[model samples]
Structure formats: C-alpha cells, structure tokens
Target chain A: MTQEKPTVVLLTADGVPEPADLAEVRDLTDVRVCTAGTLADTLPGAEILLVWDIFSGALSDAWHAADSLRWIHVAAAGVDALLFDELRESDVLVTNARGVFDGPIAEYVLACVLAHDKRLHETEAFQRAGQWRHRETIRVAGRRALVVGTGGIGRATARLLRAVGMDVRGAGRRERDDDEDFGHVVDSADLAAHLREVDHLVMVAPLTEATRGMLGAPELAALPDGAHVINVGRGELVDQDALTAELATGRLSAHLDVVVVEPLPVGDPLWTLEGAHISPHMSGDVEGWRDTLSAQFLTHLRTWLGGDEPAPAVDKGRGYVSG
Target chain B: MTQEKPTVVLLTADGVPEPADLAEVRDLTDVRVCTAGTLADTLPGAEILLVWDIFSGALSDAWHAADSLRWIHVAAAGVDALLFDELRESDVLVTNARGVFDGPIAEYVLACVLAHDKRLHETEAFQRAGQWRHRETIRVAGRRALVVGTGGIGRATARLLRAVGMDVRGAGRRERDDDEDFGHVVDSADLAAHLREVDHLVMVAPLTEATRGMLGAPELAALPDGAHVINVGRGELVDQDALTAELATGRLSAHLDVVVVEPLPVGDPLWTLEGAHISPHMSGDVEGWRDTLSAQFLTHLRTWLGGDEPAPAVDKGRGYVSG
Candidate 1:
C-alpha cells in the first residue's frame, strides 16, 4: 500500500517560487501555486502552506479555508504577517527561513556602517559636479557597535563587525554569557543606557509586541550625537517620525532598509531627511534568492517527511523563535 | 663646551604646521618656518629640512641653495616631490611618514570597497529623490582582491579586506612568502594577469620609475568588466585619460583619492564619469593628522640628533623604504 503525499499550497505574489524553484519540492509533495486572490480557493485540502509572499494578508483572510493545514513555512525571516488570531489560536507549527538571511543581512549592515562613516554619498555628489573636496572620514576599527538582537542574523552581523575590529555589544531578551561574537550581552531593557556610548546602533530584532516601537523619541534621544542607526529589522521597531525629526536636525543619521510602511509613500519626509539612506527593504536579497528560499523550505519538507520536526519553529504568542 | 643645535627648515603651505605642532620641535633645533616662495632664502644654512608641503615643487627649484642640508624628511608616505637629481645625488638622507598613513589609508580603501559593492551611492540618489528602490547588492565576502604593493598601506588594506572574508592577493616588487595577510604574493610584472580575476584592483604602490604610469590602457583593459580601481597610492600610477575613458563607457568604475593633477581641475571629464567616486588627496588624513605627522617627525628628530640614523630611510634609486 502506497502512502499519500501531503498537498502543499504555495501562496505567492508577483511570481515568487518561480518554475525552477517549485520543481525542487514538487516531487515530494503534491504542490499547488496560488496568488493572494486565489489562496482561499486553493487552501481547502492543503496540509502544508508555503507563504512565499510574506507581505500578503491572504494567509489571515483565508485561514477559515485552511482546515487541513498543520504547518506553515514563511519564506522570510520574520513571520509577523501570518500571526492572526485564528492562526495563533490553532495548533499549527510555524517556521521561517532563518539561516538563509543571516550572511547577506550581516553584509548589508557592514556596508551601511562603512558607507555612513566614509560619507560616500557626499563623495559621489562631489564627483558628479566636477568638484574635488577632501574630507576626513571616521575610522571604523575600535569603534563601538550595539547590535539590538541576538538571533542568527544579529550574531552573524556582530561577528562580521567584530572581525573588522569593532567593539560589539549585543542586547537581547535576556543576558547570555555564552555568545562568542558579542563582547557583552545585556538585557534589552538596558538598551537605552548602552545607546549613549555606541557609534553604530544596528537593529536586527524580530517584530514582536515587546520589540515593536522599541526605538522611539526617548531611545533616539539617548543615542550619542552622530551615531548611525541601521535597521534591517522590521520597520515598526523604530518610530519613523522620531527618526525623521532627528535626521532633519542632523543630530543622527540612519540607513533604513525596512520601514513601517514599505514602498514608503512618495511624499514621506524620511526619504529626503538629510542623513537618511533609504532602500526598499531588500537587504537580505542576494542573487538567486528565490532559489535559496525554495531550497530552505525543501530542507524542512524532507525533515517533516522523515518524521522529524522542522527546526526554527516560532512561538506564535511571542511572534518569534524562543529558546 | 656647548654643542650647537642643528638648523631645521620647515617648509609648509596653507598653515600646515600649526603653532602647537611647531612647538614640539622648536626647543630641539634652530627651526625656520618657510613657504614655497620663501624656501630658497631659508635653505642656505639648514642641516635638516622638513618638507611638509609634499605636493610643492619648491624643493627641486631651491635645491641649489642648500649648502648644509644632510637630512630631508617629507611628512608624507611618498617622496616623489623631493626626489630631484640634486637631492638624490647628494648625501642627504630622505625619510617619509610611512607607518603613519598605513592604517588610515587602509581604512579608506576598505570603505571604498564596501561602498562600491553595496552601491551606497545609488541608494543615496534614490533617497534624495524620495524613491524607494530595492536592488540586490553583491556580497564582498569571498570576492577576490588584488592589492598592488606589499608595503605597510597595502598590507594593512589586505588585512582589513581579508578580515571581511575577501580573498586577497598582494603584488609587490618581488615575491614573498612570509606575509600573513596575503594568500599569495606575486611580482608587479604579473599584475595584468591577476587583474582579470579580481574584483578590486587597489593601487598602494609608491610612485617610482618602475610603477609610474603602470596602470595604463592595457592594464585597465585587462581587468574584468565591473572591476573597481581604488588608488590611494598616487595620481600618476594610473593613466587618468584611460581610466576616464573606461569609466565613461560604464565598463569600469573607480574611487580615486589621488589624481595626476589634484584639486583635479574643475572641468576634467574624470569628475563626470558615470561610476567615478572622487575625493581630494586626503585619504590618509584623519582628525589631528598634522599633530601626528609632527610627532612622528619629532621622534625621528631625537634619533638623528642623538647621532643615530632615522628609520624608514628611502632608497634614492627605488624611491621607497628598502628592507
């Protein structure tokens, strides 16, 4: 007697899980691809859901139809988009593409830190106008960095920064002494005190009730003058208005890869803020990222098929992976 | 019996030797501060000359006036300005501020590498225009780098790049196996072959008979498409016209901290090149650099005054420190 293969519904947007990527998991599971519009119709008999479009609200909109869904894998490091009341109350296991983003995001953080210190933007402007101006740049070595979060991405970022001679301090949910990269780990509650001494404040924390709006006017005010804020974490982690105000006054600078609202509206003042370097939420995306995401999900599929639990399971209540 | 102090001539431009810096050496020698216009008058009785204006041609023009000059120290890494026939032929010892520039220039080179790979310039433009554009950036880690010159600056640059996980190779006047930072060290003659395989071709070699105009059309053409040329060495090391032509066609890019004619004439096409990042010749200068330069020279002064030879003595023929 042959065992039936589980049906996996790939919910995507703008053609994610391209044909080649879908082929990786197609042999093991009966697969169906659907968009936000057709997700409800496709979710009826699927026991597994690959939420490739983590930005879409279709997962919550179509939760009633996911009667057979036992597991949900978000093709993103953060799973905030899929934590609706019904999904949170259900007994479904949720996992995210954690390790895939660690290296690329760490690289992006370093790039931003170095760029801010060197004033590359000013150099480029001078180049464009045929003007030659000499300016002294700050040294990155021996500078202080505070990485807010101690997860895989945060640890990876801390290690890269430390490798280049930065004095890195990490802030997480609780203090831990076993970390190799962070010179010191402190409770997230003590972040404000640490902010005053850091030259670079890197945000790589997951979005949760406790972390959301963590960096507001008070936190921004506590940072030392000329400190650069680099956010690769979710947008809500920082208060956009407070950041803009600080940037406008030139008291602080920021390299924001993600914002509270992405595709940040055309008129958003944060875009034109004097020291703000904005990118449209693509820090972790390296070449052929779609393939990597598919491969990550395939690894979990294989583990689940062999009667083993898929790793990096998120705590639905906390909205992140907990120890 | 009283010992007469040596007369030291300090040649400067634009107020370089600030009063505080001059005070460091004033009590040790009979010091005469002069500019390019007044250098000839001051050179007549000086036993030591501090060439603070490394870019000035005054040293060559006023060489005939030097009657007692025994030692000439240039407050710069390169000694090209004082490499005149008269100075080279005389028994005058020439030394440079070599170790002083190595660390700062290396940091600048790393900054350029990170900025170029991350396209920070483009991100800035997008930010200025209030456009939220998301683009995938190339990873610097595991990328190949060919640093030309194995001296202090080049070795420091190689170390920083390697720290960031780059595969770094060093090219010097001769092959060496003892370098810890470089994976392989090759002769400068083989640079063209290596350029084709590297992502960053960093020029940190001193200006010398063998290295001047080294990176011309043929050498630039040998580099793989999209390779960046970072020159903290000297302006003449690269052929400006050839580099400009390559940058104009968008096949190559460059971050030139030094140019053949610096304070690069306002109308040079190199300034407007599509992928050019230009800064005036101040890459090695950080905060309190003048003070540091003065201190470095003072250290050597005490050694020379005590009848000991000052270090980092340049070989007149090769124009750099010889082991």
Candidate 2:
C-alpha cells in the first residue's frame, strides 16, 4: 500500500493557490491544506503551518495553543515577526526561505548601486527634458563595499560585487564563525569603522536587539561625504530621520528598499533628496517568485520530514539575518 | 640625451585641466598642451594630440589635417570621431583611453538592467506619493542576456551580470587575425538572430558602418517585448526615432547612456517616454575620472615609447575597439 500523504496547512494570508498548487494540495486525501488570513482560527490537524504573511503581526494566542503547530515554515525570508517572545520560547521547529532570495535580492542591491553610481534618475530627467549633459559617474569596480549581515543576501551581494572587481567586506555579529565565512567577512561592531573607509554600504540585517536603530545619527554621520547607502534589510534598523537629514545636507546618499513608514507619508522630505533612490520594499519580488518559494519550501519540508537537520533552521540566538 | 618630453595638444573645445591633471601632465615639457578647439587651429608642431570630446562632429577633419600629428589619443572610447573619410586615410597611429572606461561603462549597463528589473523608479514614486501598489518583476537570475560587443566594456558587463545568476551570451566579430576569443563568444551576425530569445539586450558596440543603425525599428520590434534595452554605445547605432516610439508604448523599456541628439533639446518628446531612461550622457563620468583616463594614457604612452606594441590597439575596422 502506498504510504499516506502527510497533512499540510498553508497559512498564506491573501494568497490564492494556483491550479498547479491546488493539484499538489489535492494529491493526498490525508493532506488537508487550509489557509488562514488572520491568526484567529487554530490549525486543526495541521502537521505543517506554512506561515506565509499570516504571521506578520503579533500572532493569535490560539496559534501557539494548538499542539498541531509542530512546525512553522515562514513564507517570507525574514522571520522576525514569528520570532516574537511567545514563538521563540516554543519547542516547535521553524525553517525559512533562505536560498530563495539570495540571487534576486543581491541583484537588487547591485541595481541600486549602479543606479546611484550612474546617476540614472538624473539621466532620465535630462533625457525627458531633451538635454544632453555629459555627466560624470564613479565606477563601482575597485571600490570598497560593506555588506552588513553576511548571510545569504550578503554572500550573494559580496560575490556579485567582488566579481565586478569591488573590494567587498561582509560584516556580521562576529567573523570567526567557522560555520560561515563569506567575502572579506568582518564583525558587526566594526561595521561603523568600516563605513568610514568604504564607498558603498548595504544593510541586509534583521531588526533585533543588536541591530535596531544601528544606523542612526552617529552612524549615518560616520559615512564619508558622497558615500552611498542601500538598505534591503528591515527599515527600523536605520534611523530614517537621521538618514533624511544627512541626505538633506548632501553628506551621504541612499537607496532604500524598505522604509520605516512604508509608503512614506506625502510631503516627506525623503521624496526630495536628489541622491535618494527609493523602492517599495520590492528587492525580492521577482516574476514566478511564488513558485520559487513553494519549491524551496517543498524541498525543505522533505529534508525536515526525513529527520535530516533542516538546511536553514532558525538560529534563535541570531534571528533571521541575511539579505 | 633625454628625448624632449612630448608636446601634448589637448584637443578639446574647452581647454581647462584640473590642478591634479596638470600635475600628472608634468611628463610633457614646456608642456605645450595647446587646445585645438577651433576647427582651423589644429595645433602646430604637436607630436601628440589628446582628443577630448572627440565626438563633437568636427574633430575627424582636424585629426586627419594635423600635419605634425603622429599619435592621436581620444579622450572618449569610440573613435568614430576619428574614423571619417579623411582620418581613415591618414597614417596617424590612433590610440584611445580604452581600458579607462571598460569597467565604468560596463557598470553603467549593469546598473540599468538592475534598475529596470527592480522597478526602482515606480517603487520610489509610490513610496514618495504614499501609494502602496505591490507588483512583481522579472528576475535577472536564470535568464539569458546577450551582451553585444565582446570588447573590454562587453566583457566587464557580462562578468558582473553572470555573477548575478544571469545566463550571459557574449558576441563580437571573431576575426581570423584576432587572438582574443572570449569563451562562449558568438559572431556579430548571430546577434540579430539572438534577439528573439534574450531577456535583456545590452549594446556596447562601436559606431562603424556595419554597426550604425544596427538596432533600428526592425531590430527593436524583433526583440521579445519585455526585454530591457541598454545602450552605452554610439547613439546613432540605435535609430533614435524608433527607440523613442517603442519606449513610448511601454512594450519595450530602455536605459540610454548615449543618444543621437544629446542635451536632448528643450521640449523634445523624447523626454516623455514612460519606460525610457535618459541621462545627460554621464555613464563614463566618474569622480576623478580624468585622472584614470590620464593615467591609462600615460601607461600606453610609456609602452609606445619603449618600442613595444601597446597592450591593445585601435581596431581600424571597428574604430575605438579596445585591447
């Protein structure tokens, strides 16, 4: 007899499964994949709780109360939302979509770097105005770049930048971790010091005790004039007020993929910074992205179910820190 | 017995050299670096003609007419300015600041690809306008890109894009006499055919008779609709009217570093293409760029005086083709 298909509960809020995904769900009669937009209902008989965007805010008490919540697979790459006090204390196992975004996000970082270095926006404006101004730009090659959070995103960015002849240095909690050594990996404490010497700084770290408000007035001020900043990590990790103020003075420039108050309120000064390149938190939204995410989730699920140590298990001590 | 330092003719309309540049130009004695700006005054007794802004249309005549001009070095990469009927017949050995721009221009192409793929502009607009509209974009990874022109710029762009997980195909004229064969290099003829299959098409070609008007209406229409177009090559190579029309419809998008009529002109409709990115021809401009160019020129000058074939020569057939 064929073994019974395992049960799975997909809590992807506002996500409508495509026909192909539905077919995967219906393949196993024993597998009942149910979605919950809000965390109101407990996952009944769910061996796997796929917390897509369903776990964005504080989770419902009933979610933790459910004994069936043995495993939580976050659809998003960053899992700080699920790493709340209650969830962190649980004995439940958690895995994230680490490899899914490494390349796309890294591409985003490079794109921002190119856009800033090349004065793309100004060029576009000049083109529209029918003006041919022979402007100048700096070459990214051979420049120093500091990537905070030397995880998948940092690793990918470092590799891409290094391939272009950039002197890439990656910063994390510590550099001696034999478990990971990417680019010219350095320690987080030394990141500010590194910024002084580097030309570009890309933040891909999580918003946690060690990193929240890490790039505040002092840090933003630390960057050399004309130094550029791109943040693909959490917005709260940077002090927006300080960033905008610094940019206003033309000391530092920035490209923000995430904002402290996304859809930044109208009339916000950030909209006016000539050097600022803003995107709506979309560094990882690539076409067919859902499929990539699902495939990654399926692969990880198989490994976890086989009792193999999960490829990207949660490091509760470090949270989710990568690009 | 020291050979008199070469008298350099700074062939630019505006003869201003930065202090730092003057310091480096010390190798030339009496440093008679005259500016041959006016059409009639092609520096007399000038052994070396440093052609800056050689793209200014009239330099071809000046270059060919300089009776004493022995070595002609162009500030810009494309020697099309030096390739007219007159100069082609002259024996003046032509050199260019070729390698100075290879990495910088390549970085510009990569930047355009990134900006388009990430939708940085739209996102920034939405963010500044306080509008939250989520959209998915194409991932450069796992996609095929055809980088035309397998010279220095082409090679640099391909390497960086490849590092981003892009399947890159490089194409150039594989001549029998040429020793450099970039692996996976295709012949130029294959480019027109390759358009239909590529996701991104980056043009770094020079403005030769074979290349001018190469990416015109028919070629632009032949490309798969969504393919992102980047041209750091000669503006004439791409039919400007065709590109503007295609970009207007948003069926195709482009980042143009060089355009046919730059300083586009006041009120030119070309400035209004929703998908077209036009800058004031600044891709090759970088902080302290002149220094790099001068440094490169000096290296090649040393090599030439030492009785060695310069590391690369200007391809008389291709005009400004590099090492």
Candidate 3:
C-alpha cells in the first residue's frame, strides 16, 4: 500500500513559480498555493511550506497557524525573512536554495569591479556625446579586495577575483586559516581594520542582528577614500543615509544591487548620485531562474518525503548554514 | 677620448612626451623634437627616430629624407603608421612599444565583455531615469569567447578572459595546439567557423594586409546572433559600414574603442546605434602612460647605443615581433 500524501503549502508572489510549474511536487504531496492574503487560511495543518515569495511577511504573521509544519524551504539564499523568534525556537527544519546563485552573483560582483576600474560609465557618456577623450584605466591584477561573508557566494566571488590576479581576503563569523580563494578568513570584529587596506569592499553577508546596519557611519568612514563598495547581499546591511552622504562628496563609489527600500523611490537621492551604479535588486537572477528554483525545491522535497535529511539545512539560531 | 652621440629625432603629437620628459634620452643622444611641419627638415641627418606621434603620416611623407636613419622606435604598438614600402625595403630596424599595452588592452577587453554580459548600460540608463525595472542578467562564467591574434595583447586578453571562467579560443596566422590560456588555437582562415560558437569576439590583431578589413560583412554574418564584437586593434581591421549595418538591425552589438574616423563624426550613425558602445582610441592608455613610454624608449636607446641589438626588434615584413 502507498503512503498517504502530506499537505504542502507554496507561498508565492510575483515572478515565482505557478501551480502548473509545481506539478512534480504535486504528484507526491497535496499542494496548496497561497498568496499573502490567503497564507493564513492555508497555513494550518500543512506539513511542508515552500517560501517562494521570500519578501512576504505572511509566514511570520501566520506562524501560529503552522501546527503541522515540520519543514520550511525558502526559494532564496537568504533566510532572514523567515527567521522569527517562534521558528527559531521550534523543531522545524529550514533549507534554502544556496548553490544555484553562487556563480551568477559572483559574476555580477566581478562585472561591477571591472566596470568601475575601467571607467566604463565615463566611456559611455563620451560615446553618447560623440567626444573622444582617452583616459588611463586601472588594472584588476594585484589589487586588494575584502569580501565580507564566507558563504558560497562569498567564496565564489573571492575565487573569481583571485583568478583574475587579485589579492583577496574574506571575513566570517570567526577567524580561520586561509581557504582556496581567500588568503585569510578574519573574524567579523576585524572588518574595520581590513576596510582600510582594500580597494574594493564587497558585502555578501546575510541579514542578521549582528550584520544589519553593519556598515554605518563609522565603518564607512574607515574605508579608504575612493574605495568602491559593492553590496549584493541584504539592503539593511548598510546605512543608506551615510552611504548617500559619502557618495555625494565623491569620497567613495558604490555599485548597489540592493537598497534599503525595494523599487527605490523615484525621488530618492541615490538615483541622482554621480558615483552610484544602482540596479533593481536582481543580482543573482539569471535566465530561467524560476525553473531552477522550482527544481531545487523538488529535489529537497523528494528527500524530505523519503525521511532522509535534506542538504543545505539552515541553522535557525545562527541564521545560516553552519558548515 | 669621447665619441660624438648619435642624433635622435623625436616625433610627437597630442599625448606624446615633451622634450623635457625626454631628458634621459637626450643625455645619451643629440635630441631633436619635431612636429609635422618641421619633420622634413629634421629627418635628413638623424641616426635614430623616436616615432612618438604614431598617428602622424610624417614618417611616410618624408621617407626619402632619412639618409642617416639606422633604427626606428615607435611609441605605439601597431606599426601601420610606419609600414610604407620604402621603409619595409630599407635597412632601418624597427621596434615598437609592445609590452606596455598588453595588460591594459586585455583588461579593457574583459571590461567590455563584462559590461555587455551584465547589462551595465541598461542599469545605468535605468538609474538615470529613476526607473526600477528588474531584469535577468547573463553570466560570464562558462561562456565562449574567440580572441583574434596570438601576440602579446591577444594572449593577455585570452588569459584574463579565461581567468573569469570563459572558454577561450584564440585565432592567429596559423593553427596550433592549446596554450596555457586558450583551449584551442585556430587559423585566421577558420575564424568564420569559430565565430558561430562564441558569445564574444575580441579583435586585437595588428593592422596588416592579412588582418585589415577582416571583420567585413561575411565574417560579421558568421557570428551568432546577439554576439558582441570588441575591437581594440585598429579601425581599419573591421569594416565600419558592415558593423554599423549589423548593429542597426539589432542582430549584433559592439564595443569599439577604435573607429575608422575616430572622434567618430558627431553625426555618424554608429553613435546613435543602440547596440554600439563607442569610445575614442584609448584602450591601452593609462595614467602616467607618457612617462612609461619615455622610460621604455630610453631603455631601448641605451641598448642601441651599446651596439647590442635592442629587444623587441620588429620584423618589417610581418609588421610585428615574430618569435
């Protein structure tokens, strides 16, 4: 006799997978798709939850209704959105889509670094004006880069930077010996000191209590003048006002893929900042991203149903994968 | 007990070093700086010629006046400016500033590839317009690139592109086995076949009968649709009309640092082509480049004065340093 299928709740928002795309998961589970408005109504008695709408706060708002929820799989690398007090204290397991974004995000970070050093923006402006002004461009080799965060994305970024002949250093929660890509992995407490030496500062750390607002006034001040800041991680990891002030004075440059507010207000000062390269928060996104996310969730679901531990299990207390 | 120093004529244009900057070379030779109008007057008796003005056609115009000229050192990489039949048939040894631009040009090529793949131009446009449009970007890693030319600049470009995770193949005068950076090396005759497989085609070959007008309509048509063309070699190496036509139809894109009529006429269709990223011929220029050129020439001058063959002796027949 076949075992009975368990209830699987899929929380979705714009650009995520449709019910038809999740037919693979539906074959093994009783799938119920929910939007922000219907999440609370469908959360009760669900054994599994796929947080496809990572930006939605519905999961936290309806946490009390998750009486039968045993596992939560986020369709993103970050778990900050689902790391509530109740979930942190519960026995429910959390898994994230980790490996899918490493290569694409790392490529994006390197692209920003190259564009800034090569003065591509100025070149484009000259092209548009039909002016020919020749200028010297900086070399990427032998430059120093400090990657904040030692996760998959951070390691990938460090590797690519190093491959292009850069001296790369990484920072994690605690101090460790050199890894394959980074020369040394220092403790987060020493980020300020490292900031002074690097030409580029890349923020790829997760959004947690210890990291939110990490690059406020003092930390931003520690960076050498003319240093570029690249943030592909959470928006709240930096203080927007302080960053704006620094950029306005032309003391520092920034390539921000995320801002404190998504769909940044039309009137925000960042849009007009000469030193900023702002893009909508889509750094890790590549073609067929939705299909990739759905496939990753299905792999985890198959393992979870077979009573085997799924890979990339996140530590609720630590807010990331431990190893 | 002392011998008379050789007369060294310095040809200069816009960004070339001034007489004061050539003091080191002056200490070893009787230095005579000349512009276009004065070049004919100074060319008669000079034993050495420093072609700082690579864009000037003065060398070819006054070749008959070079009675005592034994050697010519060009301040630029390409020797197209000096490749007159009279010089090619004469005994004057030619040398060029070869190593100086290898790294800078390679970095520029990689920068353009990254900018194109990451859609940085679109991102900047969105930032300027204060529009928050989220779009998926292309990843650079594992993409194919065809780097034309097997010389220092082409080799350097292949290395940097490969370092960024590209599957790089190089095309030269003839086919060869895989080198350190390029996985396969094809002959220029087979470039059309290779063009169909690559996402990026970087042209860094020197201007010569073998390479001039290489990327004409037939070759451009062979490239995969949406493939990006990067030209840093010389303007004449590509057919501008063919490239502009392809770009107009949105079938291909280009990052041209060199153009047929640079300071590309204000009304040129290329400037208005949405797919073209046009810039002045400044791919190899960097800060303190003039100083670097002077130093390189000084080093070569010292070797020439000692009667030992100065390094980087160019083969007049081939128009570049041959192994």
DockQ of each: 0.74, 0.61, 0.80
Model 2: per-residue Cα lDDT over A27-115, one tens digit each = 54244444444344546656666665523653445465355666777777788767766667777778888777888888888888777
lDDT by residue (tens digit), candidate 3, B1-323? 98999999988876555834576777788989888778889998899998888788788888878899999999889988788888999999999998889888898898899899889998998888789998998888888899998889999899888888888999988788857667688988767777888899999998889888988999999998989999999989999999999999999999999988767887999887889998788888876676788788888888999987688789899888886
Which pairs of residues collide in model 1?
none
Which residue segments of model 3 deviate by more than 4 Å? A19-21, B19-21
Model 2 Cα shift for residue B278 (angstroms): 1.3
What lDDT score is found at residue A295 in candidate 3? 85
Superposed Cα deviation of residue B92, candidate 1 (Å): 1.3
Candidate 1 chain B, which ten residues in sequence have the lowest lDDT sum? B15-24
Q: How displaced is residue A17 in candidate 1, in Å?
A: 5.5
For candidate 1, what is the TM-score? 0.97
Cα lDDT, model 1, residue B128: 77
Q: CA lDDT of A257 in candidate 2?
A: 77
DockQ of 3: 0.80
Best by lDDT: 3
Residue B84, candidate 3: C-alpha displacement in angstroms: 0.2
